[model samples]
Target chain A: MAALRRRVLEVLPDLDPAQVTDGSSLKELGANSVDRADVVTMTMDDLGISVPVREFHDVRDIGSLARLLRGHLG
Target chain B: MTTRSGVAPDGVVVTGLGVVCPTGADVDGFAAALRAGVSGIGLRPATVDGEAPGMRPRLVADLRGFDLPGRLAGLPQLPETTRRAAARVAGRSPLAIQAGVAAAVESWLAAGLHRAELPGERVGIVVAGHNLTGALAERARAGYQASPAHLPGRFALWYLDTDHVGSISQILGITGEGYTVGGASASGNVAIINAARLVAGGELDACLVVGALTALSAMEAQAFHNLGAMAGAAGADGPQQRCRPFDTRREGFVPGEAAGCLVLESAGSAARRGAEPLARVAGYAARLAGTSLPEPDLRGEVGVMTEALRRAELIPAEVDYVNAHGTGSPLGDDVEAAALRAVFGPDRPGPWINSTKALIGHCLCAAGVVEAIAAVVQMRGGFVHANPNLDESIAPDLRLVGRRAEPAEVRVAVSNGFGFGGFNTSVVLTSTTGRGRPSAARR
Candidate 1:
């Protein structure tokens, strides 16, 4: 989850890293649709996980996206 | 500053200038480099990630250390919201857009738009940009390949040519008309000419003309290399001597990046707003060659210059200086020299000609406007910077400026720009003192 939040900060440089906590909703952290999509795709690619891009729309927070990546790995 | 007599009371005049090039970051800096005859052309770094260690790119004139946010920081009067928005987008936008925004902001501030007093609905914007395939597009394509299921929402808007004008207009709050002009290398002149005509023809009070190109892709460099249109690739002295325009040893132009902006306002509007005029957009003409040749035919080139001079109501002999579109290619320089000889006559004392491209490699779409700025700088500074590498003259009849800067009283100046597909544009500019303004603001 911490790594996921870090990747989210990389995609959205305008946002503050400290405010992008695991429990922070992506939208609340100033992640627009494009920013959200880039964060999910880049993180997934880094982790070598294959998930349908449409499924990223359902991701609400950094923790949930991390959990989804863990589920795919298992 | 002696005023030339032919300027109409209703002429279109340049109120301000903004520029970003390898030579300098702003207008004054660019002019100083021009006056000193400095060459910004140098070897470019490899764009590919894993290239051979010893590989060096062909000649390139790039803005090595330009940072948009840092530039914006120097202009603090702009609304914080506007500045932040611009910086945010520029951080993620294409390089060309970032360059355009920076240039436009400089021009805007110079024109006093930061004062927030101009009517937003009456001002227009026209930016010239060519070559759509570059690093941004290459990266986007690769990103799509890596993840076909997801594409960035702003992907399409990023590359579209209109977005250049759109981004500048949105930042500055110009609500009038916005569009882009492109005709390969001639695009810069085409855009400036059209914008001037629109203001002169009474369609708009003022127009912002900008030319920006940051697409220095290795692929494009390779394409030019494959065509044997690049200097220093085969038999050449070295990269430093690659772009010697009008010289006998000239091979081809070095690829360069630059963005230049000029604010064209009607004479009446400028006086009303108390804006100091820099120069007058006296007359302009553009001609499209019927055929698509890699090199231009001198006939079309000759016609464009004559037509522009005729429209300006001036004879060929009245012009004192010429900003020649000398691309440093053997064929291109010869054809352009022949065209000038035909226009100015073979045996008569002709206009003193110089190529800004020698200092800053051919800026493609930005060449025309950048050269126009050079002309204005020369007219105001009372001197002309000679072509640094023009050792052996190819155009004997034409009087080319020499190696060192010379003291010349430039009354009337002409700038010529030609593109790949036979697109040629010629614009006539006269010093602001010669135009409709008072001499109180003379610098």
Candidate 2:
């Protein structure tokens, strides 16, 4: 979970690190559509995880994105 | 009352100038570089493998070490969130847009205009260029190189021409209508003329005319190469000699990229705001040959020049200088010289003529505005910058400026911006000191 949070921050350098949490909204963190795509791509490479891209369409926050990745890894 | 142009005395005038070119970033720097006859032409590294295997490096006039974020730092204060958003959006936006926005901001600042100072609904914008969305093609190419699935679904934003208008409008907080003018390389002048006419006709109070272009993609490079329009790989002679406009050994234009903006305000508005205008948009005219052949049409070029001079209410003999659209092509240079002769007639000494392309390569769409600014600079400085690379004149009848800046009193200057498909534009500019009497009273 910590690694997931770190990866999101890495992709969106403008995001306030203190504001990022499981409950923090990705949109509120200034993760625009392009930024979101970058985060997803980086996360996939870092975690060695495989999840359908469509699944990310509904993911709203770090917490939700983490759960989806965990489910794929499990 | 009517001015000599048959319009109100307080007609369209250019108040501020901004540019981001391979030569320089600011207007003053750009003009100084032009005076020194500095060349920005060089070999640009290829991002993609040569389409023609074993082709040498591409010769281009690129803005070296262009720092966008550093430029944005000079912009007016905005909310932190807004700045963050701009930064994020800029990261994904086209380089041309970024350069255009920078030029726009600088022009606005130079004009002493702020969003809070002017009514957003009254400010107008017109950005001109063809293929303004080259970044989309570049991104798509990068995506393919990375992986097919890496392409973003929202790539459509970068592919649309309107996106440029929308992005600039949003950044500038301009609520008025934004227009995009396309005319191949003549687009810059076309947009400027349109904006000036709009303001002169009372449809708008002021307008920002912007022209922007970025480095070409591999596909575009190949197309120019295929058309035999680009200088072949720099042989032992090197890239500097590749874009020698008007030189006897001239081959073709070296591709270059640039972005620039000019603030056109009605004389009344400028006076009301106590803003001293740089020059007057005295007259402009554009014509299309309605053909796609790469060959130069002397008749079309001649018509546009005569028409522009006629509109400016000046005889060809009174013109002090002409900024030629010499793209270093063998045929284009000769055709342009003949057109000047047909219009100016055979005199002992013709108007001083020179080409900026020899220094900055050919900036295509941005060439018009860039050269327009250069003409104004030369007029103000009391001298004309020579074409440093002109070893031999193709047309001995035309008095092309020599290899050094010469002292001359320029009262009026004309600039030519022509493009493929026979798109031709000519604009007449008069320095503030040499301005003629207005036939009519100010509005």
Candidate 3:
């Protein structure tokens, strides 16, 4: 979760830390499509995990995205 | 407005200049370095990524420490929104793209376009570079090999050379027309000519001619070195001494990296905006040698010089100075000197000549626009910069500036660019003091 949030903030430095709740979406935090993909790829690299492409389509929010990557770890 | 031939009768003027190179980061710093004969060439550090550990140190002039955010902050004149956009947009991009952003911002402000303002639909950008993905692709190779899916998604957009056009256009809000143009080493001049034509043809009121930094990978560097076209293999004394254009001791060119920008506009538009003109793009010509080889062609070189003068409607004797494409290679310098003598002649009292490459090294694809900025600097600053390393003249009768810079009121100057694979180009730039439309006056 922290890694996802960190990557999101990396792309949008102007976003307030309090607004980065897992329930919130990257789009809500002002991350464009390119920024969303960058954050996802960067987070994947940071966690040393590669989630399959189709699985990411199920991710509704930051929390769901983190949960999917964590499933790869477990 | 465009004429029946689709060319404007009005002149095109350079309204702004920017540079990010090893010699300096801005136009003012670059101008001072040229006047003092400062050489930015040095040994590429072995620790740099992708360099072999046991290989000999290669000579290169790198922009040692460029921080894009810091560079933007230094430009107090830039709007806060634009500065933030530059950082947010290109901070995580490759070094070359970041350098282009800095140069673009500097030139945008210098042109006073930000304060005066123009419709976003009327401004365009032309990026001068190709194969700009060498370093980034090489760096990503190992990562992809480890895990192919882990490659950053932004890589798709960033890898293309037109990333310069997209990023700069998005940041500057330019929407008229934009694309990347290539001519190998002559990319800069090609971009300039394209941008100038776009403005002259009335397709746009103004356009930015950006010379994107060429970040060569080790493989590309090794190829040039293996071909015996790069210095530092045998031309030793020091890194600075290796780039000796027009000198007998010159072995080959020393590679340099830089990005530059020029804002070219129609004369009437500039006057309407009360923008100060830097230099006039009086005339230019580009020709092919009909060969796909790497060697310079004497006929192509001489042809462009002659045609450029014909287009400018100025005689050879009227050309006050020449910013030569002397890359310090033995055969290349010999060919260029012969071309100069053929056009301007040995006994005819010709234009003073010097090579910006002697001080800043050869900037590969960016060399043309970088040297174009150098030519404008010398022209407006009232002096021709020194050749720095011309110990023995390749062309003694030519009035090449010696060890130190000299003062002269330069009105008309020729800036040349030649690339491998038969691209040859010459641009005629005239200072504000020069007459307006010599041929038009005759008509």
Candidate 4:
């Protein structure tokens, strides 16, 4: 989880981690479709974790997405 | 309305050109494609099934392989290259700058006009774009999603709303006036015309016009796919099937991304620098058709073209070539053809016509200038290139050149760019020598 947090921070240092906690909504913080796509593609390239395009269709929070990536990696 | 006459009022020349098109990054490659009647459309491998289907809207002049140097690459995330490009042209970085501001400064430098030659107060800037706010929104989202604690780092909103204008002013050090305009694709043309007006009125001796738009994100691409507006990949058919402009089987337009800038100065100033004048901007006019987004009013399109001619004091016969706003969509093609017929009459003889979008794909906000560059090339070359992928004629009286270039004694050319909201713009370009007129009279 800490590794995920650091990776996310490297990608978007301007984001507030507290607001992106496990249950926080990315949409509430202005995470749009373009952003989500960029995050997915950049993360896949950097983290070597392939995120299914469809998963991003409904995933709303950083915590949830981290968990999804962790499940896939495990 | 005080209507002025002659090439002087219409005589704003194109001294220099810079391009970032798919065919070739510079003017030479793009000119070659136009001469050879090449089609840039091909299958896009990245698109998925749920997206729009057909031939993937690829540029007959693909820019995918062209790489900007590492120095220029930083501009998408930072403001450095935009500044450097401007400084390379302007001799100095503008104090505070915007994306479009650097472009304007570069254009002025390309024109060989020095900053000290003209009064800074007499210089102005007009820029156009469709997605300024959208860019900010995307950046803000990226920052927020990465971490909630670094809210201040995602300054997309602040940068877009405030810094855009501030940066431009700071770079140019223009204390006079500046503004942004457009209705989507027509924005660039509209901005050019606005700057021309200020210069003609003597309110400013020089005006810089800039147009730019970024690439569509996956979501925006999907939105266009949902609208059934994108051209899909060519299947078993060859590459020519991808985007058949003015063809009987034409399907739709492909979206592209680009930015361009032009500096307009009075003839006196250009002459002072011994800069050879290119084609002149004779007349410009814009009109709106449908009140809504999807619907296009054909009548409005015809009216605007006719009005542009009227403003230039030119008859239909005077126009030698037309750089069409043909997007390859069925309705768009038919309606634009009908509008041309209405203005030119069904019997009008061979006036060379073509669409640059067929070669480069549609560059959204940058479409106007991209096509404008093509028209200037045609005017200088005295020939109109044929349209590739045009297997059969869609309009009877109109000449749709295919597979071969045709010679033309082009005196006047018109470029049209119609945006989503039925925003239509027609710009007239005339030869520097005033083609048909006597030399002494032209002087």
What TM-score against the true fold does each predicted structure earn? 0.89, 0.89, 0.95, 0.72
Q: Model 4, B107-176: lDDT tens per residue?
A: 5555654434655676666766656555445655775677543434324334452343445555655554
Which pairs clash in model 3?
A: none
Candidate 2 error regions (>4 Å): A1-14, A30-58, B1-9, B45-57, B74-88, B234-236, B434-443
Residues B298-332 of candidate 1 have per-residue lDDT tens digits of: 88889989998887877788788999989998899
Q: What lDDT tens digits, residue by residue, belong to model 2 across residues B297-352? A: 88888998888878877778878899999999988988998899998998859799
Question: Who wins the lDDT comparison?
Answer: 3
Candidate 2 TM-score restricted to chain A: 0.83
Docking class of 3: high
Superposed Cα deviation of residue A28, candidate 3 (Å): 1.3
Ranking by lDDT: 3, 1, 2, 4
Model 3: residues with Cα > 4 Å off, grouped in runs:
B1-7, B47-57, B233-236, B434-443
Alpha carbon deviation, residue B139, candidate 1 (Å): 4.0
Worst 10 residues of 2 chain B by lDDT: B1-10
| All candidates: DockQ | 0.34, 0.33, 0.84, 0.03
Sequence-dependent TM-score of model 2? 0.89
**What is the Å distance of residue B250 in model 3 from its true position?**
0.8
For model 4, what is the alpha-carbon lDDT of residue A13?
42
